[model samples]
Target: MTVSGAARGMLRTEVDRSLKTFLDHQRAVGGGPDVVPLFDAAEDFLAGGKRLRPAFCYWGWKAGGGGDDPAVFTAAASLELLQASALVHDDLMDNSDLRRGMPAAHRRFQALHEKEGWNGSAEQFGAGAAVLLGNLLLLWSSEMWRTCGLPAEALAAAQPAHDHMRTELMCGQYLDLLEQAHGENTFESALRVALYKSGRYSVERPLRLGLTLATRGAPPWTDALCSDYGTGVGIAFQLRDDVLGVFGDPSQTGKPAGDDLREGKRTMLIARTLAAAPPEAAAVVRRLLGDPALGAEGVATLRTIIQESGALAACEEMIKQYLHDALEALERAPITTEARTALADLAVAATTRDT
Candidate 1:
């Protein structure tokens, strides 16, 4: 099988195993009846993601010469749990109604509130419940990590990196929120958000954590290779996401087309469009930026404007550049042939995924 195909298979198997473990844990604990809903919500949230983070961690470990230890699997699963926490909170923050073709966590809670005839505002109830559930997932992720049986020194080495990932993600989120509210965002600022938020957790830190655990001794140049690879691929992933947000089929994406436009995401593509559009067209783009009230027709027009402005081409070029850089970094790193091939495939798949 091809690398992409193999990665997909591995990802599916890991996700299934991890989810079973999660559910079994919940059952063993006999979570309070009131918190049954929370568990249900978490299960639903975990149902349909791509499981990219765990796959990265797994591949990173294998590349670092780690065997198929149960502890590695547990550590990888913890990354997915961390991802769940991030998504739950992100959906609430973005006020997204749908995720992976299902109602978002908050939306699910809102629907239950209405169905149960609860005497409270569904919006408030949903948001509050989702927040608590996200917190629960965060705690669960930490517990998973702690119980993974890694060496004490390895665990200690990873703590600061893990904490930094969370802090940087939160900061990036805040920057994103601030940019949305201000309506005046620069390409540099948007790129910073991408690096700090998605780059570290999505690629760099996870790879580092896995490699650190796998290699009993910390090797020089490991950090540099991870940084080079992570920054490149992480940005490429986000660029692809921006393209999908605007142009992807709603059925495949599991979200409304142009949702990013509606949310006024300060993506590199949008920044390029703003810079390249004709004066009149640029004005229209600026005016519509982050306007939640923009109807479908307006969105269509805006998309057209973006495409015609040459911004799409620019974004595509950037994606290619990042992919090249990632491959170069991989070449420079001293890793096993199988591991290098897997990472290369992942890089291609990440940039080219339709959903």
Candidate 2:
């Protein structure tokens, strides 16, 4: 493989190893049979991902002229645990059955309850277990970050980004849940939710944290440029994800087709379709959007509405526009040539991915 490719592969291996080691230690030292499922769920769910957050963190550091250090890898890898915590809770909130082609953490726990002939409601037991498991992952992520052995200055500089990432993610999730409850389906609100929910955490904060570590403190201009680049790219990533949610190939996406529709996701695509569609079409879409029993026919109907209403095209254009803006931000940033090039590539990968 090429040098950059090989380096990325090595980084993935190290990140996976670090996470596994941490989880393994926690599992070994923790409770009994009851806790095993929690640990098992985490390990299994964490086993697969694009490793986007870690890569962003690593490359952000490199862009700021940091070297390839193992300690940095450990710090970056910890973001995966935070991501896992988010996914577990998100799945529970959405009542999703599958994640990465496997049963969600709650579902796994629910199955365990059923098989073991445990008392009480299996669903409630599963949900409670999932919540605790998610909390544990969040706790572990914080512990790993705090104990990464970075110098005091670097840790302090990076801590705000870490704090903001978690806080914003939680707030975004709350807003999402609230939006669904109130049935507030506006294009502007959908974009706002996407920004806070996925955009900031996925790219901006991780990049900022890495840059903070690399520089020991980020200069104002450096922070601003990374912010612009990361936010633009992150929004594009979320937009692509929204499109994929409704129309993507199930095998590639690792979820059933129309999962988002069934879950009643108030996405930008849905917003746009509602705005652009005829009243009758919009009404039909609204009826089918969140039905738990949304079948293939319902999915196909909504897909048709989205596509025919020009919403999908509009969303695609938005992705391209955001990606263009992200690259432009990169061009304006003062960073290492190699790192800039890699980040540019990452922007494309994040936005254009099928999964």
lDDT of each: 0.82, 0.89
For candidate 1, lDDT tens digit of each residue in 1-355?
2466765686678656866786678657965787788888887777777777777777888888888776777777788778889888988888888888889899999999999999979999999999998998888888888777777776787777778877887787788788777776688987887777677778777887778778755687677668889779988888898899888898999988888888888888888888898999999988887777878998898899999999999889999999998899989888988888888887888889999
Q: Weakest 10 consecutive residues, lDDT, candidate 1?
A: 1-10
For model 1, the stretches where C-alpha displacement exceeds 4 angstroms are: 1-8
Name the lDDT of candidate 1.
0.82
Among the numbered candidates, top TM-score falls to 2
Model 2 scores worst on lDDT over the 10 consecutive residues at 1-10
TM-score of 1: 0.95
Q: Write the per-residue lDDT of candidate 2 for residues 1-355, one digit (tens) a residue.
A: 1237777788799899888878878878888886676788888888999999998998888887788677888899899999999999999999999888898889989999999998999999999999998998899999988887677788898898899899999999998898788764887898888899999899988888888899988788677767789999999999999999999998998889999999889999989999999999999988888899999999999999999999999999999999998899898888878888888878888999999
RMSD, one per candidate, in order = 1.7, 1.4
